[model samples]
Target: MQFFKQIKSILAVSLVLLFMAAPAIAGQPKYVFYFIGDGLGAAQRQFSEFFLQDQLKNPNSQLVMDTFEVAGINTTYCADTLITDSAAAATALASGVKTNKGVIGKDVNGNNVKTLVEEARDHGMKTGLITTTRLTHATPAAFASHNISRNNENEIADDFLNSGVDFFAGGGIRHFIPASMKIENADALGKTIKSKRKDEKDLVKGFEGKGYSTFIGMKGAKAFKSTDFSKQDKVFAAFTYTHMPYEVERMNQYKNVPSIADMTRAGIDVLAQGDKGFFLMIEGGRIDHAAHANDPSGVIWDTIAFDDAIKTAYEFFQNHKDQTLIVVVGDHETGGMGLGMDSMGYKLNMAALNDVHVSVEDTLNDGAGQYKGDKAAYLSYLSKNFGLSNLSDAEAASLNKAMVSADAGETLGYYKLNPAALTAAHILSTRANINWTTTIHTATMIPMSATGAYAGRFGGYKDNTQIAKAMAQTLGFTL
Candidate 1:
């Protein structure tokens, strides 16, 4: 008995000395905010970065990276193909495993899959998904819901409800309303039984079933695209559908809609409420859309909006400091967006055109929807909006000829294959590298940038799936 007591005293003294000499364990970074800009790749980021710096100030300069800019190369391929869509890229980012294009997180075998956000929830972290696109938009949905097909948005909505995420905001009112309230089998929607989003009563009721309490814009007031959020015991997913309106038209259509900055601030406000940390995703979705439309003004403004949102989030992260990790990247580059017309085989003057509208497909293949005075309208719109003050006489005459000729079938726009205006635009695009392909997604890798707790997870060659895995590991969730 005396020997045992002596040994116990010695062990206790040793343990105390060891603990006294040990360094403190750093606090676990309890939060992660993963942002994805769909359809935006390296070109898009380069575009936004330059335009914002050239015109607007650095919106993301709050982070340490803004002072240094830690960038990485990331390949964006889907499970089944080299090219990918939002659904596939998003799934790759949501789940660390690549899946087929058009499929959410499930394999071809149709098995359900867990996403990082889902894992975050399983680990007791509150998860919130926010986007300028629909709440069920592919990227955010990739985190919260998994359906065999991305097209089954209604089922996706149900999945979101079941996921028990604490907060969600965006459009897609069409998905939540019940089929009864919808225009069933309308003439415009021939052969398709369009799902009505009018089932607000039941839809909100469904979230309430999951211990959720809030679903906004039920009565269709103004597309609840506001920044103010409510805090309570239940899950909240709100925001009217109506495509959320384009950036240029949003202020005109919905006076109450929050700016991207406002949305960012509001999301962090609500998502940060959980004591167990939170997983929040906020998307600058329209940057990709505007690029796809080949609209420079739209792209520029939306990029500004996206940047402002990033700035807001970075500020929030700053307040929390090392307790949060932020990962911002594009799923893929859309429109093969590029910069510079130096290689286009001509020194065309874009100073003569503004809203260039010629289609390459039509001009090259006698396709439908010809230019229809594209040169004239584009020049006019450009002069009005773009403020191109350097219209040379020769350039003006050439544009005038193209407009008239296009009316008579000259096919001078990009779609026509002549690519004069595109070439001209390329000149402007390359000055800061803001060129773009036609209005479509291109097969290009996107950009990835990071900061905070796991900022080092980026800064090298990577793939889209690595983004998901990085987020998980950085947050200590480790899939």
Candidate 2:
């Protein structure tokens, strides 16, 4: 009887150990959603959270990304520079290798490096790349194409034809068409598609020949949903001629263009149809653009829009918790943005930003030219559009100085911002107590957060290259 009792105890211990090890034995995740917020840093994200809380009048409001279990800080320096550009930063995040600035999916010696997308495809998984910028841009191109320079959009566009990626979305239609071809009547935005390619080869037709069902502009995005892709799973979609409009601009005018969240949902629905699983990369590309312009409202709104896209992935994760992994990270920090300014004396009035209804880009494009020379008219325009009504004598003088320069068609600052637009944007940002150190990329650390299968692998402080390394390990492959 004693011997039998000991045998039963041993059996119970064995069963407990087996159950605990079950998840490890389950192999790689079936679905992976990789989200990259271009130029998103700690302050950029915090400002968005603060903006939302103020907008909702709830102090306890939090971003969905802040609620993730696995969170860490990621260094963003490149191999050759302290401050990394989008191309080199993206290559490190996608290939687990750091290259010099301006290089994409290639080493310092110009040798091609295999990216995570290539590994996913090798493992019999479907891949998709979606971004608010052109698909041929640095972030997306780093994953699927190899080139010596990120500026070679024509070469990057050609790479998509044979990348074996099942789905493609966002802008860059110009690079695909021939220089002499005019494609306006067929474009959904009713804008002419002029080619940037030096060759006469029409790449859109090339994509079509490779068994891809291509869609163009807002109309194309809507048609992408209704069409049946069960027979042909490959798809290519371009929603604009260049980068997608900033969130503020889109909300006020381009209502037909799809949001980043819209594209994320669409990419998931189409890519998830396969049985072997899928890898989808979604980039909020214009946060970098807005930050480079020192437009606080533009950055806040676009980051909010990016988080909405993450919510879409989080919802999908909820249903497939055991088989899905969602990772959210920023390629690098832009603008050196901060929450407090010296004049604010430790106070940040996020609520003040609510008075401003438009972005700096729109203000310059639509209104600045109309009220340039007249002091009263320009001040009135500032009050109506940028929410600056009662300016002190010095503030008014500063704005007047900018107006004179703008009227003479001058572009000022390091990023060559319109003088009037830059002045108005700075004043608006000051009202909210936000400060920017520079209108360029900063070597600051960005945030990385994840959830679901093997999400714990990404926790703790790490370099940007480790991101791809961790993903490869989670997927049971080598980067």
TM-score of each: 0.74, 0.90
Cα deviation at 133, candidate 2, in Å, is 0.8
What's the lDDT of the predicted structure labeled candidate 1? 0.63
> How far in Å is the alpha carbon of 80 misplaced in model 2?
0.9
Q: How many steric overlaps does candidate 2 have?
A: 0
Which stretches of candidate 1 lie above 4 Å from their native place?
1-26, 56-69, 182-201, 208-238, 251-253, 343-434
Per candidate, the number of residue pairs that clash is 19, 0
Query: In candidate 1, what are the lDDT values of residues 349-444, reduced to their tens digit?
Result: 232233323322212122222334566556655454444335667656655665565556554333343333433343345433345656566677
lDDT of all predictions = 0.63, 0.86
Q: Residue 185 in candidate 1 has what lDDT? A: 31
